[model samples]
Target: MKYKTFQTIILISSIFLSIGGCVTSKPSAENNTNYTISPPVSNNKMVHVNGTKIVDGNGNHIKLKAVLLEGWLMWNGTLWGAGLTSETKITQRLEKMAGKEQTELFRTAIYDHFITEKDIEMIAEIGLNTVRVPFNHTILEDKNPLEDYSARGWKYLDNLMTWCERYNIYVVLDFHSLPGGQGAFVSDPEFINVWHSEEHQQRTVDIWKAIANRYKDRQIVAGYDLINEPDAPTGKNLVDLQKRIISEIRKVDKLHMIILEGGNFSSDFSMYDSPLDGNQVYGFHTYNFFTDETDVKNLEKLSELAKKQNVPLWNGEFGAHKLSWIEDQLELYENPKFPINGWTFWPWKRVSENSNRYRNLAKIIPGDDWKEVAKGISDLFGPSNKITPEFTKKAMDSFIEAVKAENIVYDTEVKDLLKKY
Candidate 1:
C-alpha cells in the first residue's frame, strides 16, 4: 500500500467511525471489525545474526543505523511537553479534563500526525536503514487482552510497516511497555507490577506470540524486541521470562531475530554465561548525564560478552544527550574492538522548551500556552484540575497541530552527523 492509499483508508475509517459515534467508542460484538493487514512487501530480505554480525537473506552483512519512533504509539507525557509521565496517566488526565470523546479525538490527532510517510522519507534521506518502533501493550489489545486485538492498533502497525517497506527501512518491533509495567521509569509508568504478576508475565509472552504470528513472514521486520529496559528483581528471573517468551515466539516465528535487553535498564548482563538462542541479539541502552567514561567501560564489557557468547550486540536505545556526547558514543560504537552490530538513537523527535539538555533530530515547538499546560498536567505549578477545560483544549490542540511533520523543525547538524556513519 502506498502513502496516499493509507491516507484515503484513514479518512474513510474516520468518516465511518464518526457516523457510528466516536472512533474510540467501545465496540459492540455485531459491529466489531478486525483490521485487514496488507500482505508483507518483500523488498528487503530477512536478517539474522551470523557470528556477531547481522547478515541478510543473501548473506550480506548489515549494520542497522536506526532512529526510534517514540511518543507516537506510546504517548509519553514528556514528548508532549507534559513532563515525565506514563501514557495511561496522561490519557486518564485528558479524559478527566476533556470527556472521553474529546480525549479520544486528541489521541487520534496525535497518532495521525506524529510520524507519517514524509517522516519516514526524511529518515531514509538521512541514511538510516532501520526504525525502532516502541509501543505499549494497549496499542494492540483492548481491555480483554487475550481474546482479541484492537483494529486501531493493527492499522497503526500496518501503516508503519507499509511506509518503512516503501522506503527500504527495516523495522524492529519494540514492546516498550508490557501487561504490567516492566520498569519504574517514565517509559513504563503503568506501574511496576509486571515483574511480580504471573498473569502479567503470561500476557506479555502471549503478546509477543501474537505479534510474531502476524509478522512472521515479513522480511522488513528485522526483529521482535521482547521487552524494553526491564527491571526484574533478579537477573535469573529476567532471563527465565525472556527464555520463555523466546520459546513461545519461536513456535510461531522462527525467521525473525529475537532481541533481549538485560535488567537494570539494560545496563547489566552478568546472568548470561552464554547465548540462550542461536539467532538472538543482546540489546543494551546508554543514558548518561555528564560522562562517557562509564559508557566506554560498558561497551567494552558488552563487546567481551558478545565475543564470549558469539552473538550479535545492538545499542538498541541511546542519545537524548549533548551533541558532543552523541559524537563520542558514535565513535565508541564504531571502535573495532567493541564490534557493535548496530545502534539506534533514542528519539527521532521531541518537544522541548529547553534544547540545551538533549538534542533530537526534529524539534517540536509547543505553542505559547504549552509551558503552563505542561506544568498543569504534570502537577508542577498546580494540579490539572485547576486548569480550565477550555484552556486545556486550546493548549492541547495547539500542541497537536505543532506535532505535524510539516510543522517540525529538523536539525540539519544532527542529520549531517547521522549521515556521516
Candidate 2:
C-alpha cells in the first residue's frame, strides 16, 4: 500500500513487456463461462505507464488526447437541455408521461444513434487518439440492490471497442455513475448516497470485476477509470473503495491500466500517498471556473504528486469554458514542467440551451423541439401546464434523428480547436 522509495516504484515499468505490453489473463470460468477470449490481432498496441510516462507496446510515449462521449450511454439532464435534474427523476417522469413502452423505445433509439461508427470516424478524423467513455451504472447493472447485468449495456461497450479498434483509437472505460449514487447533480440519478451503503460498494466492485472479465483480452481498451468524481464523506473512504475495486479488477485482468480519480470532484489527492496499481494513472477534472492563475497552480501540485509517486497524471475531464481558456489548459497539460499525460474534454456534444453556462462548448444542436421536451420534464413545468403525448412523441422522434452524426450540425470551430492540439 505504501512505497518507501521511488526505485521500488520503478519496478512497475517491468510489469508489462509482452507483444502488446500486457500480462495476459485468461477469462475466469465463474464470471465468463460462455465468453471466449481472443488474442489481440497482429500489431494492436497496448498502453501502459512506464515509470512517469505512458507508453505503447513498442515503448513509444503516448499522450491521451481524448474527448468524453458524454451524452451517449449516460443521459445527463443538462446535456438534454433539461436543466440540472437527476437522470433518475427525468426518466421516471418521462415513463409516467409517455408510457413505459414508448419511453423504452425512445431510449433505445437514442442509444442507437447517439454515438455510432460515424462518431468514431469523426473522432479519428479529428486526429485524437483516445476517448474517455463515461457510462452510468444503469447501463451495465440493475439499479438499487444491484442484481442482474444487462446484455444491452455490454453490447454498447462491445460496439464501442470494435469501432475504436477499427479507427485505431484507444478507450478509457469510465464508470461515471456508481451503484447507489454519488449524491447530487445529474450524474447520480437515484441520489441514495453510495458511500453510506455497503451493498452499493460491493455492487460497485462486482461491476468492475465483470468489466475486467469481459475486456481482459481486448487491447483496444486503454484502461478502466474506476469511478468518476467520487464525492465520498472523506478522502480515506474514497481511497478505500478505490483500492478494493482495483484489487478485484486485477484478479480478472492485470494487463490494462487502472485510472484513479481523487475525491471531491477529483481535486483532492492528499489521501493518496503512493500509486496503488503499477500500470495506473491519477486522473483529475477541472473547469477552472475560478481564476486562470489557479489552473497552473492546481496542475503544478498534481504534476508534483505524479512525479513523487512515479506515475502518469491525466486531465480526465474539462472544457466547459471559452475555447481560448480550454486551449490554455491544453497548453499547460503539454508543458514540460507539468508533464501531465493528456486530456479528455468534458463532453463531445449537448443541446445548445440558453440557460446553460457551458452552452458554448456544445458541438451538436439537438434540435429546436428539444427545448420543449426539456421543459416538459423540468421542474419549472407545473401541473396545470401539460405537454401532450402526441407532441412528446413527435419531439422524441425528432431527438432521435437530431443526435445522428449526419443529421445534426457540428460546431466546426470546436473541432478545429481540438485538431490544433
Best by TM-score: 1
Query: What TM-score, over all chains together, does every model reach?
Result: 0.85, 0.85
* Candidate 2, 1-421: lDDT as tens digits: 0111322332342222111111232221233223232222333356888878888877788899998888777777767777655567677767666767777788778778999999889879889999999888887875323224387888889999999999999999998888756533433443345566666677888999999999999988988999887666567677777777877887788678888888657877888887777788899987655444438777888888989988899889887666667778778888888768888886777776542334243345666665677776776653123766677778788888777877655567777888888
Quantify all predictions' global Cα lDDT against the true fold. 0.75, 0.73
Off by over 4 Å in 2: 1-45, 142-149, 186-191, 290-294, 354-362, 381-385
Give the runs in model 1 whose Cα sits over 4 Å from its true position. Answer: 1-45, 144-149, 186-192, 292-294, 380-386
Candidate 1 lDDT score relative to the true structure: 0.75
Q: 34, model 1: CA deviation in Å?
A: 36
Model 2, CA-based lDDT: 0.73
Give the per-residue lDDT digits (tens) of candidate 1, residues 130-174. 999998888777753222437778888999999999999999999
Candidate 2 global TM-score:
0.85
